[model samples]
Target: MWPDTTKVVLRQGPEVHIRPMVAADAEALHRFFLALPEEDRLFLEDDVTKPAFVQQLLAEQEAGRAFPVVAEASGEIVGYGVLYRPLFGWSTHVGRVRMAVARSFQRQGLGTAILRELVRKAQGLALDKLVAEVVEDQVGALRAFERLGFHREATLGNHVQDLSGKKRDLVLLANDVAHIWEHMEALVADFEPSAG
Candidate 1:
């Protein structure tokens, strides 16, 4: 069973709280999306300008097909993370993760904590793999995923275009839970918590 809560310390920093996203969080999420810089927003394909998009996200959460969690710092939303499931039977066991943090919260360990929680959630679902498609220019994001045991599986060239109309490569990274646990025993030590 999945634990009701998962906790982690942001890279060499203080503890951060992670909890499931709720319907009430929609407005906050909308505000957060609006606050994101263009560079950061470029990676996401969501239409934040439309209210229906946010409603759809909340609806998806209610349907159990997706998991969205928000990282809180002193009761404020600092970042958000989501794991989306594939629809087809053949790919149902795979999940794709997306993460974003407020610029002020970046590098403060919020991203790491959010990712740790995501991995835990994926494991609870018995997923075989967790995948992430990161823009090539996002070196920090790539490194962060690597620290979480993700490995680059493929590179899709010109997968996206930036606001400036520059083509960007998409790096596909995947993490196999079983393989990661076997090869990095020490890393998973702290992540193991009693099921509650």
Candidate 2:
């Protein structure tokens, strides 16, 4: 149902493992979220710190409603990518993406690798479009998705509230799935995490 597991070299030269999330990863996933700063997670809609939430995610994956993947560096979870496709709705033709990389691993091309895999899967499923909701001030995220060819579609004002009780706009970005699918390899190949 998902793409094959991959091993890629990070900018800093360490190897990271990327693969589809499994039921056994619940605990690791929780720890991963716990390791992230609140700033990196405040926009997440799912409360991933709870076991129940991970269980629900496994269920959703089994039922084919969701595809969530994880990235591990040095045997610890450092990244996550989730794509949701509604079975019945006006958005059946579209899949939404949610992803995060640990603060330490932010500039290492892990996010791009995850997104390329998500787009590849969406293409296999014949999805016409892919979308991502990024908070207005998340400059890194905005650039990551944009690098993959996703364009800004619209901005929803006050769409999300942060931990500080401040309102944040949601930047809706989208790409034509088929287009990305056709160009995925080049995007993946051109990924230069950084030699620093």
Candidate 3:
């Protein structure tokens, strides 16, 4: 389902290459996470800076339980996104997506590009819906997901704790795969230059 690589131009002008994560990326992935600020890492489910965590992610990909996409610019990883789904279970039709973009690339469409890749993968996998969890404090992330057609399905009060030990509400956002694809097409049309 993955091509060799593809390049995407950010809304703000930088170009990034998107590709599937490989085993050789373990060290680079570790470095990418380590570069993120501690505050940015707070919402992450795992300690991504650890090499073991990177290996685990690779293992999940190898085991076919996860699909990871990497975005690179200037030979460095600038964004990462993953789609995780159960192989067998009642929830097998649903995929959970997580994404992170480097601070320098935020707000420039890198996050959206990475997400677009994951959404495409989800469609290819025949997933019916995609869900994302965000802390209440992540207003930007919430808005971004909403723009992509996700709606808040539920909010779990004090469901997650930050690295600082502060409890925060966890907002569950979800959308059907078909609806998300429709919204994405609309976004593309809105951004395309008019031929006049």
The lDDT leader among the candidates is: 3
Per residue, candidate 1 scores C-alpha lDDT tens digits across 88-148 of 6799899899999888778755675677677777888888888999999888888878877
Q: Which sections of candidate 3 miss by over 4 Å?
A: 192-196
lDDT of 2 by residue, 27-75 (tens): 8998989888887887777666677877888898999989999998878
Which is the winner by lDDT between candidate 2 and candidate 3? 3
Q: What is the lDDT of residue 90 in candidate 2?
A: 80
- Best to worst by lDDT, what's the order? 3, 2, 1
What are the clashing pairs of model 3?
none
Q: Assess the local accuracy of residue 129 in candidate 3 as a C-alpha lDDT between 0 and 100.
A: 95
Candidate No. with top TM-score: 3
What do the candidate models score in CA lDDT, each in turn? 0.76, 0.84, 0.86
Which residue pairs come into collision in candidate 1? none
In model 2, the worst 10-residue window by lDDT is 187-196
For model 3, state the Cα shift of residue 82 in Å: 0.3
lDDT of 3 by residue, 24-141 (tens): 8888888999999877788888888889987888889989999998998998998999999999989999999999999999987777777878888999999999999999888888
RMSD of each predicted structure: 3.4, 2.7, 2.6
